[model samples]
Target: MDFSTPIMIIGLVAVMLALRVPVGFTLLISGTLGFAMSRGLDSTLQTLGARFYDIGSGYSLSAVPLFLLMGHMAIASGVTDDMFKAARTFVGHIKGSLVLATTFAAVGFAACSGSTTSTTAIFGKVALPEMMRVGVDRRLAAGCIATVGTLAGMIPPSVVLLVYGIIAQESIPRLFIAGIVPGLLTALAFGIMIYVRVMRKPELAPALPPSTRAEKIDAVKSVWAAILLAFIVIGGIYLGVFTPTEAGAMGAAGAFLIALFRGRVTIDAMKNVFIETSKTTSVIFIIMVGALIFTSYLAVSGTSGAVSAWIVGLEVNPGVLVILYLVFMLILGLFIDPISVMFLTVPIFLPPLVRLGLDPIWIGILVTKSLEIGLITPPIGLNAFVLKSVSPGFSFKEIYGGIWWFLQVELIVLAILFSFPELTTWLPDLMYGG
Candidate 1:
């Protein structure tokens, strides 16, 4: 293999992505080609087989399916209705509070959903219609729904964070704990943004009459199961009562119980949940295995080393390098899905980043943050596409337009995290020790 092999593989993958090929296929083919060229066909096949076997049999990977099932079951249990009701009851009377309620509800749902697409879809069905019926601006409502859903990627039980922990070899529970403050900060920032938008326009969202005392009490009662489940699952992990994988199992079991209590469970529903979970987990795991193979190819070809050395020899400040790294991710996010971006870049960029003496956990959070922002960004924002599909009332332009302010709010939160690494690290350190 020559120096150009890695560049050729990257170019081929980029072309495949441009042609709209699935990311998993793109990585698999490109990596296999590179691996064969660098290490011979027999060795490449053997390495690929070994990598697949290791990833397939890993206990840690079991958490992927469990967490995914927990999200699907949470949706099946109709927790979104309770979440939205409780949030609306608390904040519905304030200006622009419908959107505010949606944001609050998103934070709660994020705990269980751990998926931006599912969270957005659920709210599209649950809250978007209510906001529309209440005469809220469709653009504002749809935009908030789309953007706020990205919170699921940042909150505890986040699949993105979990995958990051696995790839970066960081502690999963610490990653979960580290996300708490940033996730809440994101929700609060979104609420503040909505308030300012409505306060100035006074018509983007119409305030509703306050919930009666009884209504508030009822709402609280309705959401107690969800709250308890989250506390048990996430809190258990934080307290070291269980490993992250065990936490996922507890969460899945709890979601099933909630579905039973809500009378939402049925033979068909369980089958469907299982089917969906299987499909999702399979897709994620396949992509992951492909990433592992591709990364190994890169390693065997000395591509990572060459790239890392090239980056180091740039001789820029470490801070500037970090900025550039983030900027590249943000730009790449405009074109690629989060999972694809993760598989493609983390192996290449992260080794170099850690080589700079930056912390892996912090880089993981930063990468996750960039991916979260990408989900709401223009041109191929998956959450935005999912929103449009679920709520056809808003045009793509309208939905994208509504997202800018929230995007700005997210960027502000990202900047704060960027400026003060302590913000992302504090909780983890306090909980798990440095």
Candidate 2:
């Protein structure tokens, strides 16, 4: 097959993306056209007929909607608010405590939700006002909220990591297990950054009055539902007591119970949650189907293999090659959504890296971390946009200004993960035992 065929298809995808066409449709059109070109219209038509059902019926993919439902239910139950309150109550006495609380709350919410936008939007509404009220610098408050939301990409039940596992054909449970340490470390790094920043510039954030022991205890008690739900969902998976799908189901049910017990589960609220879940799930499946179709075309046309062989023939150092691919993703991430970045690059770059005997699991984590940085990067920072939408007063300059500090911390964490593959791999290896 002529290399031009795949090149033309890629160009078409780029053009469509530049035109702001939806990612799902871009992949669908490009894949269908490319497949038809190489395999004939009849063969392409047959595959299209089967593709939807084949992807839609995937048992593993069912977990996507279930986990999404759990996240939406958690939002409806005011879990995000409780998490922020609890963290603030415990640590409010410290300098930059509100900023610290926001980070802690984000980590807690990440345990429950996988959608970064959802996390950003909720925290923007819930935490931003509180931080502003406490005289925290608007830029710092907004920046921290925007940056921490990316945690959902690395944390357990993360839809991004789940999609990565599906596309890369790695173990989902292992991916989830692998994310735990890096995710926490990222949060810790953010906490440290916040502490140092507030210490150096005291006006950026004001310390809240310390809570009494009883108040702290009460705050902790208030979030018992969130703690229990996270334990049952994440803890169950860690202990091997539940499959990812079963865990998603239990988490969704647990979230609903939390809402129901809290009297937050009105009929209308339930309807809205289900509708939102269906919408998100549908978009994800379309992208997945389209990506699979596109990758199938690459396979049939020998593009993936050809590219892999070409890269291997170069005999470059494996470390440099990995860094190059990561740098490419970081740049692409500046323009595209994280999901699109994964769908576009993984099929092309992952093959050569895997051929080099690098671990796909570790690569998955690194790719995820790169994409997480993209969410807060300049020009097209999606999380920053989300935060701005929720917060009309903060200009892009202020948001990006605050983001710069946390971005440094993120880069440091990314470097650490890259330098020590074991940081990303050890837990999974220990949990599943290589």
Candidate 3:
């Protein structure tokens, strides 16, 4: 339970993770070992067993698989392509419109899919080429897809937010609502950046011819499924007819029917859907368990409380404290996954922030918004790498270069959200009459 003990455990976990020990097992084994060393094997085993049950039996964890299922069904149903087609029809011909359209489409898709990489990969394949063909700036085009992809967390049914809500014991519905304004603001911010980039250098995003009246109507009609789906899921939740978990279930059910009606659902496809869902779900569960173990280790070593004590001891303004905290996460994100960052740090950080009078739900949005900055950050940019793998022609350097503007825009949005909690909190409050 000494300070040195937590430091040692942290070091061990980092080494194991860096060695590519499966993240789930690395954190689990490392934390278990740390606990055993500090508390004796019998007590450590008891702690581990208790922690496992506590984490597994959590009501909020139930949201993970159901939401994952929702996203998987949405993807398997071929709804993403339809969503993108509708987005392109409306915005494709505008100046840098396809890139902006991809941004627009991603926000809408993320509301349904709730996977950053899903939106990223979907747009990477569907919109990237079209932008390139129209002479869009490669940097801007790739960066737009890479950054916009992160909307999955900012939108409802967000896997990351679900995990955060579960761990923090916050309202998933409130978290969903808290994310809406910031999410839309983020999308709009990206759109504006694209608009400015295109106008400053017109060649970067040349305008497409306007769509015909019939074409515009068809675009609107094609997206009716996604529209109805979003309304049912988000609107229902906002109206309090559904909890986050129930809404996720309903979303999955709706996605399945839509897929079936479209004739895309076959027995084989269903099997694959379940198989894929299990694989993804297993990864999430294991990490959840591992993070549980890690969190326990931090508690046993008293590191969680110590970090907070140290932070609160700082003699700086609270606003500066907020900026410093985000900077710390941004740096850690350079080498860690967002979930890992969330699990490892939240116990220590959030407690102190709340003790300082910050709103937990608003801070939740701020945490995710900060982590989004890390998505395109180097050395550990997961979204950027997702694009790199699919892009045979684009350079990682170029992608990284373009990401600066996206990162800049997101940082500005983060600042706005930090200063004005209403941007992230008003909708949820209004919906609940808080």
Candidate 4:
């Protein structure tokens, strides 16, 4: 095989992926073959070993597992329930208030969990029943749960941003800072979409009896632990009190303390958090190492350079190049998971980004925004499937239909980010001196 050809390497990867091979292995096999074809078997073996050592020992990557541990501990502590309860108490009486509350809960859970699938599943189990009891339309309830769950991806302490930082060689904390405005804007957009939707079509939601002042006070108190936890974790990061890694440690410890205070902590739960963190971290690291190996081959083979030249030679507008890349990402998301998409595309897409002198921080936000849309898109929409798995009673059509307006909201957000690059870069610059 003439591994000198980038297309040949890409084709092999696609075939292996089509056969359902694990992404890590697919990259490893393909990269190793290409490396050997270009630079002999001995050189390929040496490169693979060196790359693994470099990736495994990198200090920045240590943050990955700690953040994962924090998220899992928060979930195990039952903060999701408290957050949802608080949101419900305050917002459950307005038109489509239950849906509004779900969106709020999704944001809170996104803070703790940072996993869209988990947020959707937890809320689908918790919020959907209440929405049903209040006669909220099934399509609207399920769709909101599926779509709004993606708030976590844009929010600070996002695992996706962490991974992107590691790959893009950008600052992790700056990435975290950049996510703040965009995440809140996305959540607000979802809220507005719901309010307008239910208001125009009053049949979709029923107003509940408004809560009394005392009830509202009690609801606020119930969520004090969550508020405090977010402050310690997210606040600490924003205030420069600690690095993201330190914040992760504090967040995990705080989650455990909150769980203990609530009498929800147990040895088994702690054990499960560690076990799950380790599993998730291992998978992420494997994919990353494989991506590094493959990227090394691409660099040595000059394929990346050639692609960069070809893209630049076209003399297209940089904005158009970005839009085309985003469209490609959205289409790819229809078949693959977000992590795989990140690993496969970042290396290929990054060269063009640099050649065009685009800001990586802004590009990072755009990439994440696309991934957010991918989570709700049809076919392989991970969040939608999670909602369906949690509640099989809702038809897929109802669930997909429910997200149409929210999808429009997401598209608007994307356009805004594209038009105003400062929206993504402002906070990071303010905090980090750009």
Candidate 5:
């Protein structure tokens, strides 16, 4: 097979993406055509049948839907609302309280909800109005909601981290553990940015009446169950009491029970939860299957090996090489969705970096963080667009304007992760003795 064949297939995928084809179909169609051309139709057909079954039947992949179900159940249970209220009660008297509350609330919510768009959409509805009612600046409010939602991509139970673990064949539990510090640090950095901005401008966020002692206690009471559930899920994984899939099942069940106890789980809500889960799960699985097929074609065509060798032969500093790879992903992320970028690049990039003696777990976290930045980036910023859709009053300009501050904070966090791999590795190392 010609090396150019794989390059051509990648070009074809890009062209299809540019034409706005769904990502799964683009990968599927391109992989099918490229594999057939390189390895004959009979072989391609056999491979396709095997790839779909193998990818779908993987035990690890089962965690995806379970985690997603947990998120939907949390949403239905009004756990997110309680989280926001609790955060507000604590921070309401501070400058930029609403924005700070949203950031803190996002940290709690991100533990349960792994999907960034879902978090953004929910907050756009839940927090946006409260901020608006309190005379928060539209740009700041919209930007804060959109940017903070990316926390879901970083924190525990994150679907992005889970997918990276599966693809890179790393420990899912370790990846989840590794994310905690960086995720929290990112949240804290955003909070500081909000505080400073509101301090300088004073018009961006107005203070709310301070909560009374009873009100503060009540706020904590409202979210204690949800907090305990999160602790159990994360702690179980960290202690090796449950595998990621089992932990996901426990979390989902806990979420459902939370909803049930709250009387939030009506027949209609249950139906919606399952339907949404199926839809998200199907899309993710299809994309994975398609990416598998495409990557298999690249492997057979020797594209991955050839590219890895060429990259390694350059003798570039490992740090510079990693930075270049991240920059490439960031550029791709500005247009392509994060998952698609992961599927398209990870196969080609991981080998060379590992050869350079870089840690795959650290690399995974950096890649995930880069993708998180992509969510709020311009033009095709999916999170920003989701925020805009739910917030009809704000234009893309206003949303992106507010996002600019958070973007700098994201880059600083990314740099910190890169400079000190220990930040990403410490907890996971402590837990697993790595």
Candidate 6:
């Protein structure tokens, strides 16, 4: 294959998507054509088998559906609602605290969710209204909830990070561990930003009256559903009693229990939840398959190795090349969905990274972190769009504007992570006893 085949394939993908074609289909069609153009029709067909087997037979991929089912069940069962309600009560008393609470709460919520868009949509509906009613700034409230939605991908149990781990051949446990401090740090950064805004201009946030001790306790009791579910799912993963897949099953079961006992999820709703879960899981797997096809094509064409060599020939330092890759991901993220970007780039990009002897775990964290920031970055922040659907009286523009500072904060956080590999490595080392 010519050097330009990969670039042409990528450009065509953007054109197809720009014309509003479906994303998965765009990937499949582009990848297939790329293969056929390079290897002819017969070999493209042969590549299909290996693509399906690679993604289908993945034990780690099994965790995707299972965790997704858990999220669906969590929504259906009202566990999500309970958790946010608790967040409201706890944070409502402070000025602009509700907005801060959304960021704080999302870290908890992301522990169970798989999709960044879904997390934004769910919390936008659940958290935004309460904040608005409490006289929180509409844009601020909505953006925090939406942007933190990306936390669904940043924190442990994040399906995106799971996929990156699989593609990069990094440890799942390490990826999970690497995200913890950074996730919380991002949330804190958001919280501090919110607090400052409310402090400087009191009208943007009006504090709820102080809650009595009894009120606080009662509110705590109200959201135990979220806490319990998180404990069972996240806590279980860290305990090693079950793998991420088993934890997902356990979370699904747990979500069902929360709904059944609380009389929140009905028989009618339960069916829809299952159906949605299946649809989502299928879409993800298909994307995974498309990505594999493209990767296989790249491998066959020798484009991946050639690209790595070309990159090495750029004559800048290896670390500089890594930063360039990060910038490329950031730019791509502004225009495309993170998952598709991951599939399309990781396979082609990983070889160069490993060749440079960069730590795979560190690279995985960097990829996930950059993508997580992209979820809220402008031009086409998916989380912002998700929030648009549910934010009471806000426009996408306002949400985008509100997130600019937070975006800067995220960039700084990313810089720190990139500069100090130990930020991501220490927990994994301590946990693994290395």
Cα displacement (Å) at residue 266, model 5:
0.5
lDDT of 3 at 405: 88
Enumerate clash totals for all models, in the order shown. Answer: 0, 0, 1, 0, 0, 0
Q: Rate the local accuracy (lDDT) of all candidates.
A: 0.88, 0.90, 0.82, 0.84, 0.91, 0.79
Give the TM-score of each candidate.
Answer: 0.98, 0.98, 0.95, 0.96, 0.98, 0.94
Q: Best candidate per lDDT, number? A: 5
**Considering lDDT, which of the candidate structures 4 and 5 is the better prediction for this target?**
5
Tens-place lDDT per residue, model 3, 349-418, is: 8888777877889888888878877878876688898898888689988888888889989989988999
What residue runs in model 5 are displaced by over 4 Å at the alpha carbon?
432-434
List candidate 6 segments past 4 Å from native: 4-7
Go through the candidates in order and give the C-alpha RMSD of each one to the true structure: 1.2, 1.1, 1.7, 1.8, 1.0, 2.0
The model with the greater TM-score, 1 or 4, is: 1
Better of 1 and 5 by TM-score: 5
Q: lDDT by residue for model 1 over 350-385, one digit each (tens)?
A: 887788899888878888888888888887787898
For model 1, what is the C-alpha lDDT against the true structure?
A: 0.88
lDDT (10s digit) by residue, model 6, range 330-408? 8878767788789889988877778778888888888888987877888787777777777647887889888787788
Hey, what RMSD does candidate 6 come out at? Answer: 2.0
Better candidate number, 2 or 4, judged by lDDT: 2
lDDT of 5 at 218: 97
The alpha-carbon deviation from the true structure for residue 201 of candidate 4, after best TM-score superposition, in angstroms, is 1.5
By lDDT rank, best first, the candidates go 5, 2, 1, 4, 3, 6
**Model 2 local distance difference test score:** 0.90
